[model samples]
Target: MLTSILLRLVGWLGGGVFDTLIGRVADHLRQKASDDLVRFQTGVQADTQIALAQLNAQIEARKLQAQIMEADRGWWVTSFIRPLIVYPCVLHFSAIVLDSTFMFGWGIAKLPPPYDGYEQAIILSFFIARPFEKVARVFAAGRT
Candidate 1:
């Protein structure tokens, strides 16, 4: 009888707290979704701009190459080197932004109670390791 009474009290308290938590979580998730949408749109716009710039650079490089050929200079290293440096930097910047988006998404997922063990651990690990991973990848790619 005592155990039954205790269980009933626990259930009552749990229900109220759980409902409150759920409401808050719902609001948080809605806000995060809205934010993610905005971030995604911004990322898309940035990516488009980067692509356009790369295309323009490629065209200019071709033009320079042609001019070099016409002038019999035999050296147009600037055109080749500029794009090689710029494109990767643009790509890496975009990647970092996208990764931040994912990190925010993961963070929202981990915020509610009754935590998912693997999801929590994975999100935490990703947040911790992302910077190191970026640095390692950059260095390994033979870029300074």
Candidate 2:
């Protein structure tokens, strides 16, 4: 009788333990599935946001191009503008060179403040402006 009672007690305890272990496993699986679903939903939302941002940037770029086209004046008026501005600076440089060669040991022709500023500005624009513009466009693209 004692042996039979001991076996019965062990079987009952084992059955309860097995049931509890199964319940714990089911709960863990359910939690893991829930977590995975949330992650998937978040990723989908992020992808949608990125797509929208790209579309908006494209729209803005198109608008900028349209504005530039509208602002363009005729070629006749624009063609002479650069030459008109640059010719005086060239003439001034030539005069300075002639004065220095003809009048050695005398003072060099001093550049007027306005002309000096203009010369520097023109030189800088000629050398570095286009590269700087390209870098700016790259940075702008990254931001978008």
Best-fitting candidate, measured by TM-score? 2
**lDDT of all predictions, in order shown?**
0.63, 0.73
Question: Each prediction's TM-score against the native?
Answer: 0.34, 0.41
lDDT of 2 by residue, 1-144 (tens): 999797578758888886677689999999999999999999999999999999998998777656544453337779677567766666666677787888755455667889688876765674568467656755565566
Q: Quote the lDDT for 63 in model 1.
A: 69
- Which residue pairs clash within candidate 1? none
- What's the lDDT of the predicted structure labeled candidate 2? 0.73
Question: Candidate 1 lDDT, tens digit per residue, 63-138?
Answer: 6556544544334865465356545544544555666777644222222444344434544454567557655654
Which has the greatest lDDT? 2
What shift in Å separates residue 111 of candidate 1 from its native position after superposition?
86
Q: Clashes in model 2: which pairs?
A: none
Q: How does model 1 score by TM-score?
A: 0.34
What is the lDDT for 22 in model 1? 67
